[model samples]
Target chain A: MIAGIPISKNSYQALVLSVLGIALVLIMLLSLSLGAYAIPFSSVLAILGEQFGLSLEGVDRSAANVLLQIRLPRIIITLLIGGGLGIAGAALQGLFRNPLVEPGLIGVSSGSALFAVVFIVLVPGLVSGSLIQNLGMPLFAFLGGLTHVWAVYQLARTQGRTDTATLILAGVAINALAGALIGLTLFFADDSALRSFTFWSLGDLGASSWGKFPVAIALIGIPSIMLMLEYRNLNALSLGEREAFHMGISVQRVKIKTLILSALIVGVGVSLAGMIGFVGLVVPHLIRIGFGANHRLVLPASFLLGAILLNVADLMARTVVSPAELPIGVLTALIGAPFFIYLIFKLNKINS
Target chain B: MLQAEDIHFCIRQRPIVKKASISVNPGEILAVLGPNGAGKSTLFKILAGEISCTRGQVDYNGQNLKALKTHQLASVRAVMPQHSTVSFPFTAREVVELGLPKDSKRNSERNIREVMELTKVVHLEDRLYQQLSGGEKQRVQLARVLIQIWEKKPFPRYLLLDEPTSSLDISQQHIVLDILKKLKSQNIGVLIVLHDLNLAAHYADRIAIVKDGLIAGFGKVEEVYSETLLSEVFDHPIRLVRDQETQQILVSSNSKFHSDLKISKQAQA
Candidate 1:
């Protein structure tokens, strides 16, 4: 009888994930420490410790408040949006069985952005009132995102099978239509509203607050974990739909649930931070190439790596021209586009 | 132990399987032989419960197959379809490991290695499945499905293979057939669809010849491979010759041999 050969792949993946998790935590703290009123690293640590019942003395109360109240929420939101986008992208890629597929490719981000612009332009009174009074934008954005994807799915289904090319084409068409409507709405907006809409669409973490963290966590975190748990099914699906069904997966049901989960995460992230791009498209592919295509590893690693990348990008956005703050979306595209192009070239070479 | 009773199937208002019925005992190897568009794959799909039959039912061990959940059916049978493609570069071992049930007693890594060795794919274990040649991919896929149904305790496992050896060379074909024979000796039922009638004749306990979505003839090899049936089903004359020493049948198409047989028949009459 032959004994089992030692397998290092799973262990290697676990180690990589552990290292990334630690790095992400450190980056999150580092992001919290750098700003116009730069808090000392010691002061940031003291404030964090105090929050966790460490009882550190001589920490400046105002600095503590700034770190705890303002910077902490923004940093947390950055991580949430980043991690959410990454996992959502990975899940979408796996569900669609195409590396080029991303959350935005399915029209979720554009659909959400269009509805968000509509809320800001046509219903300014509701948004301009107060933070508490402006709940309609996120709600409408989520609803619009879900509705558009459902419509695309329906349009793509024919004779009990969903053709991937048709689905992607329909998503592209919907995204174009949504873009046109957004442009029309923007053209009619007042100056202040235009600025807000532009900043929102370009993606920012300015609206981060403790009040909204629970909603983000509930919407993004739970679904991301659930998608990760379905890793085996996703692996089977990568082989193709019929093969997955033969392996006992309900392929149609998995596809629908995966799409919904991805849309929910993308919708919530966009509603909070406003249409951040490239993290979803790039992070998952990078992780798959680095750690192999097992979702059990790829999903979590993508989430952590995404959070770290976005947090670092957010840090760059804030400090590059300090006190003015470039949009986070701009930083991502500036960095991500070249890398995406390089990946396409690499993929083509491999295929050839 | 596996039975498809009067199964019928259609796609888009066109019948693909026309009331086809077949059964395989626990230790038998059943081969389905057909031309293009003869519903061999459709029959395999129905037998594996991958698709529902439009009429009739499939029963395994007195239990209705339709009543079982997809996972439940998967635990008992493994099906490998033609044209397995991957968009991502899943490693060969990882692809094979996907077939093993999560709750198996033996270590999954051990089972994966064993199956790969059985299918002679151990050398390709670390390579990406997509980078391999067509024959290598087929072998890896075969190992995957084999690992899927390889239980420690004896259970009636069934393998439904659709042209599994087409990409393989002659040596690998015999190796695959040898594996199926070993499985049959262990009371595993094997149902394979083949375009090569010679391979089917050599390996199958029974041959089912299908034409136009229905069975033209199905029985022991000698009964099903008659020249008259082959001519009618394939729309071409076939000559069946026997080895003088081994008495095994060989199918051929030689006009001169047919003419000589006609002359000999005239002389005997």
Candidate 2:
């Protein structure tokens, strides 16, 4: 229904991508303007314009601190996390040749989340300042994700082929084991660490700052570029592994690279933003339904749509309850689940 | 030319294809014929480089298969597998375009249209590939493979297919084989595993009859479609009828072995 206009697929996809890009920019500006302090949209623009020597009248000085010091980093980090999660889902689904697959289905989130819990619990000294917050915790989480993915791939492989069914089963086992391990680690945590951990675990973009943005960008950005480079191989792979092999793809090599890169991006996102569910799973599915299932179109569209969806959701998260912020992970599911169900109904109506 | 020598493929030490040697030259069609569990598909896989044989080497135009990378080998050969499922809702045209080799110098548009027309699947080009019927999907896949080797090359090329016409009706079967027949003019060799004896007899320029993971008969259709050779290879009585006007061989294989299972068991008892 999103692409209901009668047009060529290339032009239609272009129109959709452009719309999503514009919407992302608009939603970011909107998010900056609407919060507890309520900076006006024109003043938000003037404050941004003042940096380039185009100052305007009545742009309050205090509002500039709230806009630049507080909201901008949050918006930028929110976009990065959402975009990374979306493309990770798209690439993982393509590599597995299944629409149901997401980054969590492969155990990256739980694995990374477990290590984060352990890092916070066991070494309370590291949690005090920028050293632990910026690099140590996220790095530990990234390595944990990498280890679990390697284990899952090993369990799924038979001879040379990685059976997708076995991969999912292994992921489920690792998730359960990791979940239990995280719970065990939590019992040792002090009150301060436990409270901080709870707030972070619920997926907060409010934690984003200028200092953390650079690392998040590098961690999520590199893997996204790598994953996007594999569009051709992933396209061929969906036709079946042997089919891809016959077309000159090194199936095992592509499979491993795709899995690792997706894990890298998803691992970074989970460690950076906590457990933001629904965006990875729902965003890619929405794109595939709106646009045809070409990875060339699906990947970019998912990235943009994901950024837009999460930015808008986060804006609502901060504003809807005013001083009491809602957990983004909970809100994404609450809002996105109903929309996903509606799309499924629309698809069935067309099919019938 | 595509060549595999003494190919032995095993699983858990149980040989699926053993000591099966065959070669397909440019400008010819080689139909691999056998009953179920005869390892025809396994041999086809070995030849296409989908799986490495446990005890043999495959070569493309005298170049070692193991030494070749995916991109290098892909330009030389394309394969249409027995079953291929696209996970997403890609249109038939998009699926076919997936076969366009990255380094192809030809016009992809003309190549796609020409291949789809030859396979008679142009009408279904915009339809979702997963929504197609069995026969339509087969033809679309055939179009996908054909587009890969459609352009003329200075070097030899090969196309391998596994039971490409199993789902097609009689007329569509002829259409499919006729497309392969025309590939001979483009200097592309085709090796197909065929289950239908009559279709193989009519379309294949040469034949390789495999039984028990070994070649039971190999030569021209006239040389290999013998009464004793086919009957023993298939483990059943079969009759070969020749068209008097055209001098073409036809096969019929409805005999006592295919009768009621209880009657055959009683007789054996």
Candidate 3:
């Protein structure tokens, strides 16, 4: 009534979010229906029903297995990984109070990639026969992500304050160090291991399995909820640290919690998909610009928007060359870079 | 009442606020007026509990200021610094809403509208805060601080402003000072640091002249604005004249002993 708009503010936000969520779901279903062995939409839904113990008619066994065992996991993994990256990006941007700050901008991706490479290259023989090898890559990647962010946190903190400039500087230094270490690991890798590491670093959601779903859920879901709970606090923080303190927020505690939550989300995302970029940075910015700066709406919108972007990017990655897939990371960065440059110029023009 | 006893502060081992002592009673408007580098902002920071005093105690309403949690301090006092920059664009209404409690008694939209209107920023409510001009941003910030201090019932509220109207034009400066004067009628303790001497003389019930990180003088406005005190504190001459029609003090020209002084003596005779 005040703004003379058609819908209530909260309803408008909810409507937009629902539409995005439905679009993401539809894109995922479409993703499952595509592939070299194109399955029909009906068959895809049937396989989904079968997996959930619902009796569905005319569901072919081979098609069901392919949809359930392969396409379904890949799609789910893409959604989870993309959503996690988006939330992480939003949280980090809020924490740093800068739209330019992304999870990867602070070296979490490279740190995780370096450790993932180490795990793959040094223990190729162990992964060949070990059941735990299924968990090894993600576990090591998570640990690496945790370690890098912790170092960045420590470096950014001075007298109980996290200076954004210092944090960015530390991230640059750590990213370079991690990059060098990853290169060293690549030199000793055998041909097969090298290829695997290369693909992992470039990032792919091609290795999704039912066994990995629980891990992804635990890693992404927990932190996502935690970050969402901190939404109000993050909104206060956008007013700046001093104002946030005046609003009765524990500024130090909130910063640490946000950083840790972001780290966890980034770790889970990198473990699942190697090192996807741009989703976390671009999705949150897009949401903030479209909506307002309220994190209550921004965070959830970011999650849905992120899922859609990644799914669409994955769709492009898999279908562009057909059978010989382009890495999802390459597609995201290729698209994200130009868009990011355009955004910068647009912002500059607006300022001028 | 707000009290600071022997507050000592240093930045990088250089003393900024050295053993400063002051107190403000309820319904009082205390102005801290000083020249550049007088550490008025630092003193305000100490009172707001933004920084810890090296060797002093700040007591607010019988509770130790340092002991109270950040949220508790926020509930009691609202501080507006000289400059604020938000990296992202937020609507003016949204910015004002940040000051209210999450479960505020009044409707958030209505309250935002009230504060924006009071600050004469009602039309700018939908405008992006960052896109607004500097004076507009200052007014929005004033609205934010006012909403922060406003509550359902009358309680002892502390409003701390640091050069709030520095970015505003002459007319806007009067608008902000008038708002501060109105707050005094509501029995709120208003503490403001102002560079304009005449504004402080007109609006502030008491003036605390700070010099070299210390209170050079603190008393009634008339007592603090004497020629000797003004010249000594500023290290420059300022002529103070009283208007016969309005009986208001006007400061003009920077002369140590001018024609205005002779006029002041003649008017007293």
Candidate 4:
């Protein structure tokens, strides 16, 4: 019960969750409305109201098209990817017991990207503008993510256990190796392949549509939800693996399940949104700072906060240099780097 | 009572613990004494169900340790490792609360409060776990394990501790041993790993000395502890002699006397 926090253990989590929920809805509406077309908030609501058969009038046809056809899909993808990465990051941080571990830094997405590149270069027939190809990319990406993480896990494991330092070192080595492979692919890829690879590397959300929405949701949403449900087990793991086992938690199961689930979510995210970095790492850290490290609070809160963060970053990407859009990935780094530095400073001050 | 018989543990084709057989009965503290690398912690791990033994069986009451469900074993015993490291900056209160089982009918908050008070960590309820001193952390972990087996059931429960007193000061060590002693009154058996021979000699009702991954001696303190047995187990000359006035047996390492005698003999020569 820190004075400024005002959260008493049990009810505090519910209250924060409700608040985050409302804020997420508000941000979602704002993101759907404020873009290149500048649709009014009232019009956005009117467009949404029509879905419920309220039939609100006075909506411009073009604004409706912009809201439904363009912005709605982007927002959905952003919300899912953001939420997925956030919870994955939180679970991973809990598993590794290190605050600095994240999907972006740990080569999970790099693994997905590398695999997606391989699919594009090695098996171009699988992704030739067909619905199945669009679906096949995320599947290949998931396998890539699984492979990279599996390799890292194998490398980090010594005597049947994973230590934090070894895991970190393995992640670094995997990330470097994936980067080299990606660079090698980029060298020989043709024009269209090169363009797709470049956009995927920088994380382009412009290609999002209702067509790929269901696939992304199935991959990212399910795993993220599964991770969220293990909040108690994850909290138990904070006490280290041995203590967690004594507390009746299946520690090895938790590790394997979380690693696989996070890899899937991160892989799907990379395939759909390209390499949107820092949402996973930054969002969970911020949520933990605000709501203590209880996984019950941290997991769900990270989800909502992650969506809010990515939506805002995507908004900035669209509007900051109006008519000339910046990559969403670049904007997130711009936002995330300063906050990372601030976290380091805050941690140093606390230690002193 | 908890019983482990003929336990053999190996890692990478190397034997770490060999042919160890021991048991802790109700109303007694079994202190395991062993030098470093003698596999004391590994034995605790096997008994605590943290790892499976290569060969042997651990039984609680009549149920095989490996056969018992997690929740069933959880109700029967709790284990505190040699070092407890928590990642997040959990409040000491939160750390204790993590011990409560999902289906436990006991009032969790009350148990947390009572155990914290019992372990003398109530004052540290608000402090972050990582910020606590080593002794404080050990006490907090002790409180957690105590909370797990706090409720008295129809059957006896067990608590396995690995060097519980390693980080505590002399007074704190006494407090912990006293707490373990109190637990015996409630029919809870405790298996504690101890490095201090004197502490084990005084507090433990039974002592099991492990040497080179094998049990060198195991029995009631007075029956098993002798000059030759301890000296051989510890690789140091030891003597168990009665004090003339107190009529209580004292454990003496005798290093000073032996070294002095060597110097006198050199001078004479």
* DockQ, every prediction: 0.77, 0.76, 0.67, 0.67
Question: Candidate 4, what DockQ?
Answer: 0.67
Candidate 2 TM-score over all chains jointly: 0.93
DockQ of 2: 0.76
Q: Rate the local accuracy (lDDT) of all candidates.
A: 0.83, 0.85, 0.83, 0.85
User: Docking category for candidate 1?
Assistant: medium
Pairs of residues at least 3 apart in sequence or in different chains that clash in candidate 3 = A248-B71
Better of 1 and 3 by DockQ: 1
- Shift in Å, residue B245, candidate 1: 6.5
lDDT per residue, candidate 2, B1-269, as tens digits? 79988989998899999999999999999999998999988898788877788998999999989899987888889999888888889999999999887777458888988999988899998789988988888889999998888887899999998998887899888888998998899899999999999999898989999999999989999899987889998888887666556767767686653445335345546
| Model 1 stretches with alpha carbons more than 4 Å out | A1-10, A125-136, A157-162, A187-192, B153-155, B243-247, B253-269
* CAPRI accuracy category, model 2: medium
* lDDT tens digits by residue: candidate 4, A167-231: 88999999999989998987888877877777767878878888888888889888888989999
Best of the two (1, 4) by lDDT: 4
Output the number of the TM-score-best candidate. 3
**Candidate 3 docking: what grade?**
medium
Lowest summed lDDT over 10 consecutive residues: which window, candidate 4 chain B?
B260-269
Whole-model lDDT, model 1: 0.83
- Estimate, for each residue in B67-169, the C-alpha lDDT of model 3 and write its tens digit: 8987788877888888877767788877887788666765766777777887889898788998888778888888888787676445587888899888789
Task: Rank the models by DockQ, top first.
Answer: 1, 2, 3, 4
Report residue A20 deviation for candidate 3 (angstroms): 0.9
